[model samples]
Target: MTEPAAAPARPLRRDVAAALLVLVVWLVPISEGAIQAAPAAWWPTIVRDLGSISCLFRHRPESVSYYFVQVLRSGRREWEAIDERALFPMEPFGYRSRFDRFMERFGHRSDAARLDLARWLAARDRELDPARSPVVAVRFLAGAQRIDRARPPAGRWHKPDPGAAPVRVLSSHDLRESDRKDMSEETGKSR
Candidate 1:
């Protein structure tokens, strides 16, 4: 019986240098462009490059945190400048940041929502009586599907606060061509 030869170990310094070099090369364009177009677009590649550098160098690196902070700051500034030129806003980034902040500050809210949902589930536990609760039956109909639930008409769905003053709010949607004409005519009368 013959034993297979073990693979030779790669040079640690060379691997680290190579990894760092690769990371630098990869991040220069993506991070720079992402900061202007989408600040968050930098994150995926940044994390990947950072991880690669970390793996190739230290088993327990200390500079990882420093590098991350530096990169984040630079990327943030670049993104701020880039965002000024953006015509359309990126909503997901705002939502993600909001959720992150919420999670950080009110960690309890998530738990509360979870517990509330669980309590609701428990109240509607199926073991007691399967048919007592409302039944939901979904099927694909051929021509026209009937909607059973009661809902407000289109414009009513997005109403403002009830207690607030009843001033008509302008919305891009739900406004007719006649409505625009009326507004313009009213403006002309005031002028």
Candidate 2:
């Protein structure tokens, strides 16, 4: 048992080598993730080649501590005026993993009050209901890549309900204000 434990450390000698080992063991595959996790360009190519994960050193726990508070300590909260930026922006899958781990660690020990709080949070999930949360509604509606409100064929005109916003007849995300103005001028209200 002692020999096996020592052998594992022997294979992970250098700082970079150890970092790669951790990533290989912990980094979930992108296809199995909600967000794409990729290595930053600054990460060692050799490490990336060995582990098949993002070579990003900035957020890799091997390069730094794994605690969120520690990351905040190392970054904005600690060095407030440095104007540093992340080498690789983190995404939702990593967050999911972190939250799952947190729940696993503490869910059992939580009191009735804590359990009730969790239930309340679940009831208020904005993703499942937009009307109850205007902020979530705005973010979701406004961030859509393209809204296809094109009239269904010429003869099948459908009247808009009074409650609905004016349906966009023809609008592309590529169009600028000037383009919209020009089109509005050329085609009147129909466009």
Candidate 3:
């Protein structure tokens, strides 16, 4: 009788490999959270390196509101205030992404960051209308609204009306020195 042929060995399945890869990726965020919660003394060098990579995964989400004041020259003697969103739309993907990044780094007590944001808005306004001058300012707003998770699933969630939510103004920046100088020069010319 002929010897039976040995059954061919199977290679690793594609589905299994993919599942393993997903699991490893999921572990990154969990490990990052644990490291963040742990004491600084207990952190290892490798954990620090991993934490940097895990920045893309933000476990804590906060609601942020951005408000702005836009001043436009309606006449030589009068200036009009318009809604900032009307002048500068955040609907574009690139602008929205950059704004989000700026908010991520913004602090309640950081005047420098607020000044930078004001400068950026002034520059953008100038770029949009080179023939005219406008003064633009920005304020950072944030608030925390709690949800009642203890209630039934159908009605467990509650969100305050956006207009009604009390917002803390973290920072505010007005016109820069150069802008003030320009305004003064224009006033002199008008006189």
Best by TM-score, which number?
3
Candidate 2, residues 1-191: lDDT per residue as tens digits? 45554444444368878787576644533322224345333545444344443543333232111111101111122211111113113334343233323333343234443334333333344344545421111000001112234622344322223224322211111113334666788888565
Candidate 3 local lDDT, 1-191, one digit each (tens): 99999999776799789877656544554465566642233445454444454335434434334432324332333334344554445744343344444554454446777666667766777777878755545555555554334642363333334457775666655565557977999999999
Task: Tell me each candidate's RMSD, in Å, in order.
Answer: 25.3, 25.0, 11.5
Error of 2 at 177 (Å): 52
- The backbone clash count of each candidate, in order, is 1, 2, 0
Residue ranges of candidate 2 with Cα displaced over 4 Å: 1-96, 113-117, 126-128, 131-191
Estimated TM-score for each candidate: 0.16, 0.17, 0.43
- Model 1: colliding residue pairs: 35-79
Instruction: Flag the better candidate by lDDT, 2 or 3.
Output: 3
Window of ten residues with lowest summed lDDT in model 3: 67-76
Model 3 error, position 34 (Å): 5.9
Across residues 1-191, which tens digit of lDDT does each residue of candidate 1 receive? 88999999878998999888766666654464444432233456454434343113222222100000000111122201111112123434333332223333333235444333323333343344555432111111011122334632343222122224232211111123434766999999999
Residue 5 displacement in candidate 3 (angstroms): 48
Ordered from best to worst lDDT, the candidate numbers read 3, 1, 2
